[model samples]
Target: MGTINTTTNERFFVDYRITLNDGQDIKKIAQEICIEQTVEIPEDCVPQTHWDYGITGIVEDIIPSDKIKNQVLVSISYHCDISSYSVPQLLNTLFGNISLKNNIRIDNLRVPQSFSQLLPGPRWGIDGIREKLDVFNRPLTCTALKPVGLSSTELASMASQFATGGADIIKDDHGITNQPFAKFEDRVQRVQAAINEANAKSGTKTIYCPMLNDEPDLMKKQVDFCLKSGIEGALAAPMLIGCGAFVSLRRQTDLILMAHPAFAGTFFHSNLHGATPAFLLGRFFRLIGADISIFPNAGGRFSFTQEECNELSDALRMPDNNILPAFPAPAGGMRIERVSEMYEKYGKDTVFIIGGNLQQLSDDLSVATGLFLEAVRNCACATKEIL
Candidate 1:
């Protein structure tokens, strides 16, 4: 029952693709979302003045889907101020309540230019990270110090080996938080020490990025600890810590932020519901300041398809007025043997993360990582222009 003030143009729009099963009416569901997402009142009882001000969500139109059967795209418009220009509020306004609904997915969205600039997305995006590693014109290489349960000394030794082999980055696995087996401080310190020595010996610029988390205070403390030890980058699961907290860290520090997709699958797992993997992992994470966004590689260990990975890559690296391009890291059980294929897929503007395959190929981790480096640097599709 919401009426639009056609005179007012201060609004944003979202294209929601709704699947019409059981002969459901597209018009009713669109109106229902307008009511449910906004005023939370019965349509008949909605205040006249509120409608005059266009206070409730408004369905711009219902466009029949061209791609899928029984699917329709509803374009909804919301007053710009409703989101308060905050990343968290914008997301909540976009998908908070509707996320629980069946067969509704966010197909695409648009916000005003001013609104998009409220938060400076990605403190150190793809170019900044490439500068930090001093690797350019080729796919950058990264690996996680992983498998948990390892002592800090063991992980640090692993770090030294990877650094010696000239990998661009050696980061902590998302699971390697403040576990008692190798506490955050102890592990970060040891790993940095090992990488530092290796860099000194080999003249490589291998950055050590620890997984930072906990309360904001604790995360700041962790950053301080790492900064003092000459560490310049870190990783965190934005969904696990909340996107607002993640942005705060980006605005407050200079660390290159690597975003993990942990606990994010709940938001984009179903074909009939939730956000798309490209939207949540690539577009959303890039907007919230992920210098590098990591996802499970297609054909590696997860269910992501080639089309989905392409969408994700486009969302991250595509030029945008508001967001700088971020590195799309196709990771999670990735193998070194697929380096050439992955390079052809993701191209040079990517960060390839290969974990256990390095060890599986060689007893000497450095030799394994060296082979990884060689594989990536000499891929058939490559034309390196290191700067």
Candidate 2:
């Protein structure tokens, strides 16, 4: 076992699930990873000078799992300098070539404080978001504007209604991009204006987070436009745009970043193929400056298990040095009727994002949105009483 250390040269830990092929040697496979992840050369070919300088990955342990035959859990520690504190390099060093091999999955990863501090984490996490919303002691209600064909005016109208009906945050759908029907700049300006009007009328603090997924230059322009329009945050699909894009946005502006899980499903779909939902949607996203990490909820249109959902929630809220807990926004097929159940399951520091159900509930968007907020309030009160 590797002892806990706080040195500048601390090591990063990676946990992988390795399934042995017929008659394949476990020790050999472990050594193969140690070579591939770091030196990318045969062990014997590696120069003694490189090994002496701590440039090689060390296989800490490999324990066969009793629950599953032919499966073993391998733990490896790599010297922190291998990544040079860069996100792209870190990912490359962690799973670059190994990702191509079969029967191998990255299960978990741990970065020491020295390396973690080098990354730009959440700027306005749970507490900052709560302060902005001014709704303490209750899970915040969020909604998305959707059905890609709508024009900028139509989308702005929907945003106004959502704010008027008391949604804490209104976000653009992941599909709402720089399309003809709703150009990015037009949609952002119109929707933010509408949301501001509704807030002025209702005296509510509803934040509008515009969706931004463009080239680096275009993304920066969109962010600047939103900020100039008095918008407080943005919704970014980190998987589609890349982690580097998300981190750059964090460093450029203090906007609240709500990470949308658009292309991230592959990472959590299989229990034995890729990362767990907790690590990808929760810890990793939070580490890269996502104030709110969104994921598909259990019993939704998606197939995430209840245990997986709980684990994701725990990962987002767990304590870490200088890393604030983010809001785990449970979305996808969410409805007004499930607010109580979701509230009980996720506790108070969650953001419930409902969409299609709200549109289907009533002809009037405001009426449906009001019902959703009422359900959230009722759930908060009921939970308090039970406690």
Candidate 3:
């Protein structure tokens, strides 16, 4: 059964794939999810007023699958009030306790506009980012300043070269925090200066995105520092910093938020356990105001399949009611030689991140960056010619 529309009550729907044990009653599992997700007590124990007001998870539909023995698809709807208009709370309501139970996995969630509208969607989505880069016709090029031991000056030099060679966005490697080798404040100031200098020289508008990984108060200060330094964006790992923390940052600043996929693998490591890559990296990240979602690309060092990558990309770009689309930055062990292949698979709206490969390809960072830019442009031209 599909989603049910109820105008009488605003409900957010969650779809679950439940694999049953032999002789296990399917109705009992559905009822357990309903009670556990909402009131967390026996159904009869729930207050009558609360029940009338839709505070309980209503099992809208359940269908048994013949393909898999004891496997059933269940759709449960919970009133929007259960979420308190918070991403973390919403997540809790969706699969907080049920996640601990075996053989139950969240397949998808359909958020209604009433609840979704209160959240911070992307401030700079696909169009906004393209406008900032002024590269409306081609896929955007991105690279990371890496090898964490480098001094602020050294990292700035790398930023300048990448920016000068036509990289649209230059971000600090996720491994870079406030380490002594390159202090956060010093690194951001120097890198922003270098990128600004390069942009001035080349008449290109390359942007620098620093990583923000401090505590809440300090992270706010870092965001302010970036804004004051004329930096337009920053990278954040929601899994490391809590999702609530990321949402707070989104509410406070207009900086382009690029979500990093560090420490997120555990959620998708098991087939029957955690959420899918599409849900975490694409749907949820975009909903939480990530203008760009970076994930380990298929055929890269990561274990994600090509089908999973395509599904994640669709989740990022596909239209949701009012939520703007985010750019899918497929990275992680991507090589310079694979630009054409990536462009063909992901199309022009993507952001291709090539990092260590640039250094491996050429000793001169500027020359290697140039080759990457040329490959991307060539692919765009060929795609256009074909069309």
Candidate 4:
């Protein structure tokens, strides 16, 4: 077991460093870390909320290490016996806010002898999602309902058709906002209603994730609204808003969260300073309670390679031996035509989201949707039988 100082009671501390942008100061960074103990959780674990599961750890130390870039290094010690909790849970409680809040990096975790046995990662992982989705032999198909300029009725209607036509998860385009023509509340209620209608008639429980990107308070409201209306998940971009926002939302709600890749491009773009996408998006997001994280698949609009995509999938699906696994959703320029090949490449633990291709299939929404659905079902079933 890894011990900090072999002297007395094993104390668990987080050795971290924070780097500020140009013109930033240590005092400003210190103030950001100056927080009191704010315990988060619910009265009943079943009715849990996001704010209830996390703690507010303040910056305890600051260093002037020239070796490190615009960074701050600090160590946080926790006294509670964490032997009962899993590693993912411990990490979530410790540095869940690293990327979302101020510029901070968790260089190392000093686990005490008492809690060293806890495994840190997904339990069922990618294999589990495939089992749940029942697509083991091939890649999964995914799509998005985008260009949030349409009205609630339009969006809901599209959702209904998409569910009927066979898209696995009809997510909102990340760019969609709560505009006048298509308000968030009205759109969510209508789209959820449409999805419910489709599910009842088709015997398929398709998920409808609303783009719940707003201010902190409004974001919470959006989540609450989705839950009340029976929405399955939410489309959120952590970098654009904050990962802490999603963490808080997950603690409060019980819906699966599909993380979007927006401002996150900046982190993975760099080589030396920033964190890796697989570690941050695949591993950390799961720890922070994201059920499904959306990323740019290789050969799509973004530049992530096939190897990078596979590595990310492995990270997300890898068995944690301790924690629940989150699903890996590959979006950005995905299509239904390549469903089979994508499945073959990505394996079973994937939500292959097709966004723009759905729009180009045909003007007749119903026919286009039907074609897409047929392809997905055929591919998914064929893959399953082969497996």
Off by over 4 Å in 2: 1-8, 385-387
Q: C-alpha displacement of 181 in model 1, angstroms?
A: 1.7
Score residue 4 of candidate 3 by CA lDDT.
34
Candidate 3 local accuracy as lDDT?
0.87
The full ranking of all candidates by lDDT, starting with the best, is 3, 2, 1, 4
Give the clash count for model 1: 1
TM-scores of the models, in the order given = 0.93, 0.94, 0.94, 0.68
| Candidate 4 structure quality by residue, lDDT tens digits, 133-213 | 454554455566677678888888888888876556778888786989888898888888888888789876677777878
The lDDT per prediction is 0.85, 0.86, 0.87, 0.65
Candidate 1 global lDDT: 0.85
lDDT (tens digit, per residue) of candidate 2 on 1-387: 233232355688898888887999988988898899888977889887667666788889998976457989999999898887778888888788887877777767788877655565799999999899888888888999999999999999999999999999999998998999999989999999999899999999999998998888887788888888888999999889998788777877989999999998887656666777888888888888999999999999999998889998898889888888899999999988889899889988999999989999987888888999888888878767321
lDDT of 3 at 287: 84
In order of listing, the candidates' clash counts read 1, 0, 0, 22
Q: Which residue pairs clash in candidate 1? A: 122-289
